[model samples]
Each structure stands twice: as structure tokens, then as C-alpha cells.
Target: MATFEEQLKALESVVERLERGDLPLEEALKLFEQGVGLSDGCKKELEAAEGRVQVLLQNRNGTRRVEDLDLEA
Candidate 1:
């Protein structure tokens, strides 16, 4: 599995490539597909981090309990 930092770097590169605006139609579509995959990867990375933070904050006892993630009324 790619680390969070690695996924972030890949996401950044994808954005840069898209921003360059020089790709031909076929190549641009390919880059767009890759960007979508990278976007999902980034989202998964963030969700994983949020889960870990929840675990640490809640001090779960060998089981995950997510109440710690919500502190608003």
C-alpha cells in the first residue's frame, strides 16, 4: 500500500499534469482517469488517518469505536 505522503505526491503530480493543459484528447482522458484513481486514493488515505486519530483519541480496547470523532451537539 502506498503511504499517505506517496499518495499525496501522486495526487499533486496528477493535478500538475492536468493543469499543464497540453495533453492530446486521448492522453488527457488517460490522465483524467489516473487523476480520478489518485483522488480516490487520497480520500482513502485521509479516511484512514481520521480512523487512526479516532482510535488514538478514544483509546479503543482492541475494537474501534468512532464516537470520539464527533464532539458537536
Candidate 2:
């Protein structure tokens, strides 16, 4: 499996290619689909990292307290 950074880089490359506007319709569509998948994967990874950060913050006082992170504030 590609690391998150690799996937992100690949997504960027895909966007650059698409923006060039020179690919055949079929190839462009394929790249677009791949980009969407990469974007979704990156989002999920980021959310997981955020959750881990929240947990660490809550444990700063040396007590292991797990709580749901409220991001709506």
C-alpha cells in the first residue's frame, strides 16, 4: 500500500495531468476516478490522525482518558 504522502503526491500528479487537457476522454475519466479515490483515502487518513491527536491531548496530564472529539464548535 502506498503511504499517505505517496497517495497525495499521486493525486496531485493526476490533477496536473487532467488540467493539461490533452488526455483522451477515456484516459481522463480514468484519472479523474483515481483522483477521487485518492482524495477519499487521504481524507480518511487525516481524520484518523486528528482523532489520535485529540486522544494525546486529552492524556497530557498522564491520565489516559478517551473521549469523543467534538469538532462542531
Candidate 3:
């Protein structure tokens, strides 16, 4: 399995290629599909990492405290 960074890089490459507007319809479609899969994988990896960070933050000071992160603030 590719690492998150690798998947992200691949997705970027796919976007760049698609933006060139030179690929045949079939080829572009294939790349689009691959890009979608890569994007989903990257998202899952990021969510998992965020969960880990939250766990660490909550466990600081040898006590387990649960809190929702307010990213919108």
C-alpha cells in the first residue's frame, strides 16, 4: 500500500495530467477513477492521524479527558 504522501502525490499528478486536456476520453476516465481512489485513501489516512493526535492531546497529564475539537473557531 502506498503511504499517504505517495497517494497524495499521485493524486496531484493525475490532476495535472487531466488539466492538460490532451488525454483521450478512455484514458482520462481511467485517470479520474484512480484519482478518486487515491483521494479517498488520503482522506482516510488524514482522519486516522487526526484521531491519534486527539487521543494524545486528551491523554496528556496522565489523565484521559475527552473533548471535541472546535476547528471552526
State the local distance difference test value for candidate 3.
0.92
TM-score of each: 0.71, 0.78, 0.79
Lowest-sum lDDT 10-residue window in model 3: 58-67
The lDDT, on a scale of 0 to 1, for candidate 2 is: 0.91
> Each candidate's lDDT (Cα)?
0.81, 0.91, 0.92
| TM-score leaderboard ranking | 3, 2, 1
Model 3's TM-score against the true structure: 0.79
lDDT of 3 by residue, 1-73 (tens): 9999999999999999999999999999999999999999999998998878777877547776657778899
Which regions in candidate 3 have their CA more than 4 angstroms from the true location? Answer: 59-73
- Which number leads on TM-score? 3
Task: Give candidate 1's whole-model lDDT.
Answer: 0.81
Q: State which candidate, 2 or 3, has the greater lDDT.
A: 3
Query: Which candidate would rank higher by TM-score, 1 or 2?
Result: 2
| Superior by lDDT: candidate 1 or candidate 3 | 3
Misplaced by over 4 Å in model 2 are 59-73
Candidate 1 lDDT over 1-73, as tens digits, reads 8877887788889789889999898998898898888889889888888977877766536765666445575
